[model samples]
Target: MFAKTTTSLFTLALAALSAQAIITPTSPDSNTVVKVGEKINALWTVDSTDNWNDVEIQLMTGDNLQMVPLATVATGIDGTKVASYSFDAPDVSPYSKIYFLQFTNGGATTNVTWTTRFTIAGADGSTTEPENSTVYSGQTVQWGTGTLLSSVTTDGSSNSTSSSNSTSDATSGGASASTASTSVSMSDSASSSDSSTSATSESSTSASASGSRTAAGASAASASASSSNSNSGAGQVTVGLGMVGVASLVGLIMAL
Candidate 1:
């Protein structure tokens, strides 16, 4: 009877150990921030004695007694070979400080492991602060609908494109203004140079005209002086000839 009781006690202990969780979740811890529609990996390490061949990953919320299943992350994961399960995070509303991942052995609810609480952000990069104090009427926490990450990324890219276009337009406008200013400056300089050249030409022409007038006046005075000298010589010659002829006529009458 003692041997039978001892064998029964050992068998019960072995059964209890088998029912305990052999999977240990390692990721999606307190510091993890999961985005909606983003790929997330639920990483874990399994005990060497694990006998489970398949597993199911679930997104859970609330305390242990009132735990709520938010979504099924993955099912039929090969527990024997895969230490992690990858899935797209559901489009669930931002939940702060109360979200965790639960891994269950295939067909056994008792054999399960849970990761530490993590945050889920919306597609608009919206998230609540950790340790939120909002009051809840029930023990179960529910996630509302949220936008997808793809939509947010596309919107951000569009805004960036618009900003680049605006900057390019501004730069082009500035360049045109600068070019206009330079053209105006060059035109003003050219006008000033033309005015200076015209003034110099006029001064040269006036000087040339004054010099010609002075030369003409000198030539006329020289011609007048030569004509006066010629007339004076002719008058002296005529007076001398008349005086000699009269002297000759007086001498001949004395001889007779």
Candidate 2:
């Protein structure tokens, strides 16, 4: 009977030691707050002989510390079993004030590495409140202070609690595409305006050249008209002299 009890005690002590020889989370401390969709280095120290093939990563969030499965990562024994995993913080609406990490082997009875309690929040430290919450006079609202109005309206009310799950996984790829298209359109418009300006400049040059030629032609035409008028005046004087000589000869013949 004594031998049996001693054997049982030894077995229990061995199990305790085995359980104690597990992973140790060593990156973010208890007071650290993580942002949604932010990549964090999950550093840990592991036993060299332990199996790392089926290590499960989980996040315990919310006030109740609800378990949410994260991912399964691989750990290998390369001289020092110090493992570092990159983890992207999840988006949970109404930030998780009480959150921690749990890393364990995939087994019914296995040792675990429970990290310190941290916070999971939006990138801006923003949280969502229940839509049916009641606010009295001078009560702060959602991260902002609001002044109470003179009148308060209470039409319908209910006593219930609800939970919402949100994710920040969607990226801004569509916005980037829209910006690229806008840039291309602006470039095209600029090119079109440059072409129009060039055409206008060419038209202005052509008009200036045409105006200069018209001015030169007008000057030449005025000079030619003046010369022709002076020649007509000289011919009229020569004809008048010949008519006078003929009248004088007729008078002399009459006197004879």
Residue-pair clashes per prediction, in order, are: 0, 0
Worst lDDT 10-window in candidate 1: 146-155
Highest lDDT model number: 1
- Model 1 lDDT tens row, 1-256: 9999999999999988876647788998877887776766778886656865678777777665567777665667677677876666566544455678888777468777788777777767578754433336754343332222222222224466999999999999999999999999999999999998999888888888888888887888778777778888888899999999999989999889
Q: lDDT by residue for model 2 over 210-251, one digit each (tens)?
A: 888888888888888888788888889999999999999999
Residue 246's C-alpha lDDT in candidate 1? 90
* Cα RMSD to the true fold for all candidates: 16.8, 18.3
Residue 27, model 1: lDDT of 93
Model 2 / residue 144 / CA error / Å: 22
TM-score of 2: 0.38
Backbone clashes in model 2, listed as residue pairs: none
